[model samples]
Target: MSRFLFVVPPLAGHVNAAGAVARALLARGHDVAWVGPESALRRLLGDGVTVYPTGMRPYGGQRDRGARALRSLWEGFVLPFARFTRPAVARAVAAYRPDVVAVDQHALAGALVATAAGLPWASLAPQSMELTEPLRALPRVDAWIRANLAAMWCEAGLPAEEYVDPRFSPHLVLGFTTPALTGPAPFPPHYALVGPALDHDRPDEPDFPWAALDPRRRLVLVTMGTLAEDVARDFYPRLVAALAPLGDRVQAVIAAAPHTVPDPPPHVLVVPRAPVLELLPRVGAVICHAGLNTVCEALAYGIPLVMAPIKHDQPVTAAQVVAAGAGVRVRFGRSRPAELRAALTEVLDSPPYRAAAARVAESFAAAGGAAAAAIHLERLATS
Candidate 1:
């Protein structure tokens, strides 16, 4: 059996996707291990899993939007993260001696180390941003990114010629989204759109008052994701006010930071966190910040969305949802209660939205998830 090692970032979402794929590989009787921040991996995959701890330096929170945010993301986090984790990843490779490494898109150090060690590696994209040509629109930004990657390669003792978009692996790049959700794009031949690797074996299920939800009303889940807790603090109150008008016709489940809202409306259920996979099936519609994980999870259950993109890859994901006819978009910062209510109403009242979401769901199912990713990685190792 071929041994596989997964190298992931400290971020929970990225780790979750990699962990799912790791679980799949283990199920196939292949030896699978992980290398990353021990805390993050343990939080996602549990303490039973084997993981080599890679030290991490947290990014100083910079709350910029648009182009500035993109710049900050690269300069502030990506570059530093790669440099900081390179030694740990290299040590892991030398000690573990895995046949192949599955590298998360954000964790460039893994790719560099694998290349330097002459090991086959695959890129695992937890989100769709890397699949699209994000830098095509801005040549200067593309150049800037390329220059930074080249510099990082040099520092890691790898040849600059070997560098070509660290976000993609030269041998194999696995995307966690279907073309239906990503729209028409010229992807490379080595890229496999393997859809989302959803974790079916969730060991811990949060206690949610399922019976408390109104059975008579259509349920709508309102969440801004984990990273957007600060943004949600401001957005949730408006969302609650917007959904208040629906009253008995529509019930809302808002996942907000603890005590963000002391007294929510009668129609709303405010929870610090909810079991999303458990809750998605029961909800008829979702109003969110268009996070890729949430979007794919919702579509997997054939639930429609009302997207309000705040930052990062959210706008791109929202655009894809709108293009695919699966959701409606509203302004995040400026949207009032009336506008939110209207958009939520449109998604719920329109049959076309549900139909389009079902189409994407079909595509997601056809594009094999964790199993397909494991097969591809196995082929890469054995080829």
Candidate 2:
């Protein structure tokens, strides 16, 4: 058995997906250690994988307000978080000397560390962050891009230009998205389009009015994801107000993060972030931030979506969903309660939307996620 190290940021989605990949490796008799975030250690340990906790920050605030989301992404991700993580990853890699490192595509620290160690690295992308080329076209983002590249350069012993150039080491990129949902053409040969990695078979103590769910009602699962609790605090209340009109017919299962719960709404069943796989299957539609994890989950379950693509790669992913005909988008900038309500209503009531989503679900079924990942990694070791 070969030693493998998998690096993931602390967020629930990232940890959950990466943990599954690690477990698959372990199950196949490989020595697996997941490195990143103290918060993830408990979960990884429970999944039967060794954990090397690195200090990391979860992005976004409990408030889902636009300003808070933007600030959180800036402070939690593009700033001090990445700066603080590099040395921690370097330390872990030096001590472990893993034969192969499977890292989240956005985990630049892990990528840098693997590059410096001269270890083969494969990207286990939880989102479409590294997929789109249009991100380079953003205004004034090049400065941050250059700074980030310089940091990566220092970490990997490469010139800064290597970061910007399209050519470099052959990276094996595996996306948590079906080919049906991704953008057209120009995909790198090393990149593999895998389906969403469903976290759990089912929840242990699945609660949230499941038994009391109104059969006549259309259930809408409104979530911003586990780490996005802060963002939900700001957004869920507004969302509740928007969907309040459809009260009896449309019951919302609002899974806000702990401490972010608003005043109870009669039509909204508020839970402190339940397992999404459990809740999503029962929902008729989902109103969520365009985090790739949530998007792919909704698609896998054949649930139509209305996305309010907030910070990071959300806008790009949301656009892809619309392009795929599986979902509709609530345009960013001055996005209001009425707009969200309208978008949700339109998608839920539309037959074509559901058909498109179900079609994508078929595509997802064909894409063997964890198993394909296992075979690929096993080959990496054998080769």
Best by lDDT: 1
**lDDT tens digits by residue: candidate 1, 118-229:** 9999998887665785666556767888888888878877776656667788899999999999987888899899888888675444679888899899999988877777
Q: List the residue pairs that clash in candidate 1.
A: none
TM-score to native of every candidate shown: 0.96, 0.86
- The whole-model C-alpha lDDT of candidate 1 against the native structure comes to 0.85
Q: Which regions of candidate 2 fall more than 4 Å away from where they truly are?
A: 44-47, 56-79, 155-169, 201-209, 227-234, 257-264, 332-337
lDDT of 2 by residue, 6-105 (tens): 8776666776677667667777888887777765566434644466767655453434444344444555574455557777788888888788888775
Query: 20 in model 2: Cα distance from truth in Å?
Result: 1.8
The TM-score measured for candidate 2 stands at 0.86
